[model samples]
Target chain A: MKNLNRRDFLKTAALGAAAATLGTKSAKASEKLLSEDRLGVLVDTSVCVGCRHCEWACRLAHNMPSPALDYYSNPTVLKEFRRPDKTALTVVNEFENDKNPNLPIHVKIQCMHCDHPACVSACIVGALTKNEDGSVVWDDGKCIGCRYCMVACQFQIPTYDYDVSIDPHIRKCDFCTERRKEGQLPACVNICPNEALVFGKRSEILRIAKNRTKRKPDIYINHIYGESEIGGTSWVYIAGKDFNELKMPPLGKNPAPGISEAIQHGIFAYFVPPVTLYALLGTIMWVTKRRNESADKDKHDHHSDSHDHHSDSGRDPYRTSGHNTYRDSGHNTYRDSGLSTDKDTKGDNL
Target chain B: MKPAPVKHRFFTPGVIILAVLALNGLIFLAVRFISGLGAVTNLDNNTPWGLWIGVDVAAGVALAAGGFTSAALGHVIHREHYHAIVRPALLTALLGYTFVAFAVCVDIGRFYYIWHPLIMWNGNSALFEVGICVMIYMTVLYIEFLPIVTEKFMGKVNLPGFLETFNEPADKLLRMLNSGLSKTMFIFIIAGVVLSTLHQSSLGTLMVIAGQKMHPLWQTPVLPLLFLLSAIAVGFPMIIFESLIASRSFKMKPEMKILSRLGSMVAPILGVYLAVKIGDMFISDDFKYILKFDVPAWMFMAETGLIIIAFVLFLSKETTRSPGRLFLASSLVIAGVLLNRINNFIVAYKPLYDPVAYFPSFGEISVTVGCIALLVLIYRAVVIYFPVISHK
Candidate 1:
């Protein structure tokens, strides 16, 4: 039975190693191979009417304690910009267009669901994963609540359930994965009165966004906010004013994990660097030991010769007139005492 | 070289104060577990990691690097003169790591699921690498300490009544284990050094993914290399600091000759760390950010200035030769590294949207202080009972 268990353990270990190697390779190779039919939403801020019905719908759909529908009509809430938190999955904030103050822009904030997510790469326990449908989702059961995802997120979208004492989780918008599976649009998209949010395949939405900007150059901004930012996002945006004016961060086109992973993997590839480092340390230890051993032998020989002469004169070698001679010969005595004692005890064992 | 315990009173006013602080920290921890981290800490979504991670984990790990450095010098390299300091260094490291793990348990929200990293691997995450390395290294450290435990108890396992029969068998088993372990200790030493290198650098990699969130002064591509170099630079100094403090407290003559040699080794490593840091900054054009006269700029200047001072002090033979001067220089290096870590993890990091500033609460500060005090107390207790300090 013991032999059988040992064999099983070895087999499992070997298989685990192989799986780990293959998993990293596939993850790297699939960086740009996003699903062709991945879902996305294009938000046209120019057309948004600033009514926060989407926030109410999101709360209602997610089983959160939302206020009465009449309460959301109060524009005073928009006066103070708010972020999506544990209580709310999505929020709408008002940004006054500097070029035209009369026409204010309403921006909806939630998880961007990047194609190459930093949170997915930062989660130490594989709790977060970038789904094929362009949604960055998390598994609560596997999450250790390290909150590294919060730090890794370029958009800074994920929030923690700090209020809950037991089984706290990281909360964020999951792109309404359940609604999509049921052939229904996201709660926010379905509730938009002006069809400000258009949902479809990412490529189709990008095409439509380009066509709209090309057809009416005066109506839309020249750039799409999430077309390439952080390796693209499921939620794209087009606004009349600059994205900065709408409170969107200006991010580079490259994926957020690109540089960090590059350096990390470069050094640890095939575990070559670690193995080589260990070998180098061992070699240094061997060389230093040989040199020290020879030096100790020379010192021992010289000490023994001095001891014979001192004995002939009938005086203690470790003691002088009215003082300890060992204390005066600092380095030599310190070394000889420790080294000779070690030799007497564990020398043969080494 | 057999070691004997120093004779000192077990209880003192200082120990009483530490016990009070520890009790207070325990109460706060109990509240934290019952109510949540929100009750005790100022950590929010904008600042998920605070003083616990910055000080307790990062600084703790860096200070514990003394164990590997001293072990390499004394055992693997066979520098017999360094043998006196190795055991104490190991004990400090063991206690430091134990508290670091405890701090992680407190800091993590799902403390029960802390073992998930072992089964569910995310090799791409730098944190994953750190977690695995730390776990394995901690185990190796414990195994390395087994010989000490065996040495303390072998042939002296005196048990009363029901447990008397087990003593002989236990002693025999320990003798077998000790003989076996002594032959293979070099492997663990090599493994310890390798693991330390991997994780020490990986700690810096944890911040690299922050990219724009981190201030330009600290965010560079060669952060892993810099972290590794600084950790190596601080290793010997940490040993010297601990050795001097331990000797003074125990009323023993400090091993000045060997310690001065160790002090001499710190200069070259510190010089290399400075060169790499400056070279990386210049190459990345991050020096431009230093001209802004902002908080991050001033912090950067302070951190670098402290290290430069330590480097210069260590270069002088007179400074390295004096125990008092050496202790001061080593303290500066420790403070510089500690500040660098805190700045990288907290001060220099600016979340994009959140406007609320974060400062650790009183509960947080007390818990960190209490953990350090508890570690010192444990170190004292272990050295007093076990033969950790070499006999004069």
Candidate 2:
């Protein structure tokens, strides 16, 4: 019965291991996902005219409620800074351009579509995918509305509809994956009246951003925002003001999920650590049990020996005289124990 | 002596108050379901998770570490003396994880799709690890609690309907199950400890991907280590806390001898945790961030201070020997760990464009408090109905 049980256990364990291996593959960010010829967007905030047309166009493309085209012309809403929320996938916030006081810089904010997107790495269900074309898109069918992606996003881009309890989507900019497939630019990029928003190959736009900054040094900042931030985002930006002044989150060059994933993989590395700890703990338990039982038996033996000595002294003192040497050894132990001089006398009498 | 059900009347003034709190929470919960989370919570687009995920889920999971810690000590280490306290701790973990799963369902926007994590796979996500571990551990806990059920109703099963014909069969089935479980119980006992360790640490990893948005005072690569250590440290105290409360309510003498010994071990564990925590702060040079004395800084100070104070209280012989002082110390540790989870999830998350700071609304507070009160009431009911707490 025990042999059969052991075989069954091993069989079950092997099957479990197989299921676990086939169960969860690492997200797309597991390997280097930078496909050659990947697209990117370059935003020149210096050339933006604060039209807010991109905001209107973004809402229209994503099937969100959009007001009339003239409604976005209202500069009153631009007074206070805004972020992309459930109501809008992207919003252009107007920041004061110190270089030119008259014309405020209208910077369009959306998902950066990072090459190493944290949301894609962080989504519990693999609901968010990082496409090879350099767009991070959320699958509505896969999202469980955990909102972990929102927390993981460094850009604070993804938004949720808290008002709608059921089937609420994780709203985020998908970089117009649909339009790009149709050979059209993103709605925001298409409607940009000032060619301020340029969409092309990531490498080409990166070179273009650097050249533009180099050609007009006074008009743009030396650093191309998102060029290398958080391992190079697909959305690069050039503004006269600092990126912080543009309200972009300060991030290190390393990817956001680097440390977390390393620790995760290290803990479950081939399931060796957990299984080793399990075996080690099982051995300890087994050893402790054996030691405890043996200790109890030793105590029982000592009690039984004392009873035998009592019986020999009380009833048949001369019967076990051949065991005197053993008694003498016991006397030595009694002396060393120092539990009591009474036991020592009893040993000497023996 | 074998554990037996505590014989007591169900209703009391405290229980009445708890019932009222549960009722009040249910009303708000109904509103939450009907109108939406926006009606009940302060959560919006800027802050997706709030009190439910922080206090109800994270803190709940952390405090439930007593189940694994006691299991490790009693069963894995074969410390026969600790066997008396193990059952109660298991019950708490079982209930705690159940509520945690329930809270996740309630908190998620698509409540019906809470099972997506089971089929969907994301190996890199910390939440996925936590979710899977928690689900498996809860199952292990339920299986662990089955012996108590068998002990309670093995021969006493009396079906009240036409199903009464199957009473003997039910009893026989339970006997078979009891034998099977006894033969193979070690697998679940070890698995419970392993699953607990994995999830407790992964809960800390949940906040790591937040990067710079999380306050450096609470954010570190060693956060998972700190979380696991802190959870292990608090385990005995949580057992002590609930054990004392159970003893008081049942009008039984507190097991001071075993409890004091348990309390004695807490200091060393807590010392290790505090050393690692402060050492990490120094290693990262985030100690300066604390000196800035902002809200996050103050929250951080309060969290560590409570732990330091609890650690000191635990070291004193008098505190452990006396039930009141031990209770106070345990409460301190519980509050400290609870605050740590909150500080990490809520206070530490600072987005770039947040217009206002996030705080739990009245409705959210009502539901959280209500759920806890309800949990305690259920705990009381279980102890009364089952053979859990042992009498010496």
Candidate 3:
């Protein structure tokens, strides 16, 4: 029985090891997804006019609250790094490109809609889901409003509607899923007079971006902001200046969600191992119960047979002496220690 | 054994104080639910988690470590002498989880959707595991406590037909349930151990996923290991602390020998924990981050200092046995543990470009305090009424 217990322990440990390996593998598998015909946008800093038209159109299209700053305002909000809030669906921030300070690089900040979104993975209630079309959508009904998605989002795109006390919602740029589903351009794309924000099939967007960069080497930077950034955001950007100056993190091609998903699954995959362990433990407990009962019955029979000769024996000698020694060594060891005192007191003595 | 008649001796000053605290807490919770999180919390975009997660959930769980201690020794380690303490420990675990669930409700902005876990199951979510495990474990704990319920409440109904049921069949029912639960208890005990292990570690893991948002001092791969070890190290001591206070209030003798033995076990584990922490820092080459003159760095030092003080105090052979000294050490360990959790989840997590910082409002604090008070009241009510503390 002891050997069998050890073997079971080993099997469980082995299963745990296998589960961990499987978890890591699943994480890698999800990461290995390649999108060849992906659509993206390329924003060239050389041509941006710091127009708030895209922001206006985004708000109008999403039915979000208009910003306090009218479209004709001085565009001073562009000076600071600003993101789309609950009210504002998109915001254009101006970054001073050292290559051409006279022409301020206006970067439109919104949800990147990464190929693998952290928000989708972070949401335990299935409130957030990333579509194959690459648009990340939110289902408020399933949402616990935990705001974990907001916390997990690397770009800090998701915002909470804190004012809505009755039914709060997390607001984020959805890449204009409604517009795209209707085969129409995003509001921001449709309003871009300079052709600065382009929305198309991700594959075509990549092609156009590459073609533009190749044709005008001196005008545009060699990099496409979303082509491989953070495992490829749906909306791509073509930049004349460095992306970092525009507050774009130096993200890797590996999406933030993929690695996190891997780690999350790796840790939680141990769930199955425990259930199997519980079954084994239950069996052991059952067997022990039966053994204990049988042992008690045998002791009772032995006592009855020995009653004439050994009437002095107590009802439960096992409780008083035999088991008690092994039962509580911590207190018993401290109270009446054997190894420290007498060597001969080891014969099941209490 | 036939459960003795429950003695009702209310109007004690302790009960009154507890009652007042409970009332105050309820009012505070009302304010929290109505006024929104900003009205009563120090939470911000940078630090999404704060005092509630730190003290209420993390610290509360550690204090309830009695469950793990009793269950592990009695069930896993298979030392039958400590069996008497298991039920109380299980009770503490149940109450602690109940408080944690309440904290989650109040702390979460759209707490109404918390039921989303059961309806919308996301297999990949850590919070899903935490939510599901805690909920199920809470149920299992209550089920474990049912024998106590039967022994106490069922025996007192006094209806003629019901009274007849209590005589022979009731004894059999209790035995069958006890044996059945015992047969099933190992699974839940193991489940509790495993679930607590994962969630406690995941508390640290939750911060790790925050990436650059968290301070370097708190972020490390070994956080899971650290949190789990601390929970284990503090588990038995917390039990000792709770039992000591109960013994004092109930006018019973302290379980000195048991507590002393537990203390000795904890001291070595604390030493090992310290070694692992320092060794992890050294290996990661993140030791310099601890020296930085920043809030995260100072918080780290303070957390380490508290643990060290507790370890040193309890490490002594003489101090381990003294009930008062053991209590002090346990308090420090708990304080250090709480501080570590808070610093990691709240104070240390600083993201760039966050304009606002969060502080739990009076309402938030009230709700948290109230939840704790309720747990205490429940615990007191149980121990006073039931056979929680075994006879001398």
lDDT (10s digit) by residue, model 2, range A162-183: 7876678899899998887898
**Candidate 1, which segments miss by more than 4 Å at Cα?**
A1-28, A286-350
Between the candidate structures 1 and 3, which one is better when assessed by TM-score? 1
Which lDDT tens digits does candidate 2 get at residues B15-93?
A: 9999999999999998888877888999987888899999999999999999999999887776656677888899999
Q: What is the lDDT of residue B362 in candidate 3?
A: 72
The digit string of per-residue lDDT tens for model 3 on B1-392 reads 11222244545788778888889988866666776665566565455567787778767766676686577665655444455456667778888988888888876778887787988887666666667777777776777676566656444444476477566675666667766765565566677666676666555556555655667676665666687788887787778778788777767778786678778887888898898778767655677887676767888899999999999998798888788899999888878887887787677767555777656667657767777778888888877777565544
Candidate 3 residue lDDT tens string, A88-186:
877888887677678878888788887767787778787888776667889877887777776677777787755444577778887788888798888
How far residue B40's Cα lies from its native spot in candidate 2, in Å, is: 0.6
- For candidate 3, what is the DockQ-based docking class? acceptable
User: Per lDDT, what order, best first?
Assistant: 2, 1, 3
Report the Cα lDDT for candidate 3: 0.68
Q: What lDDT is obtained when candidate 1 is compared to the true structure? A: 0.81
What is the per-residue lDDT of model 1 for residues B1-392, given as tens digits with 9 covering 90 to 100?
A: 34666677767787888888888888888888999999999999888889998888887888888888887777666765566677877887788788888998999999988899999998789999988998998988888888888888889988889999999999999899999988788788889889988998898889988979989889876777788888888888988898898788777888787789899999999999999899767666777888998888999999999999999999999978899999999999998998888888888788887787677899999899888888888888888888787756
Worst 10 residues of 3 chain B by lDDT: B1-10
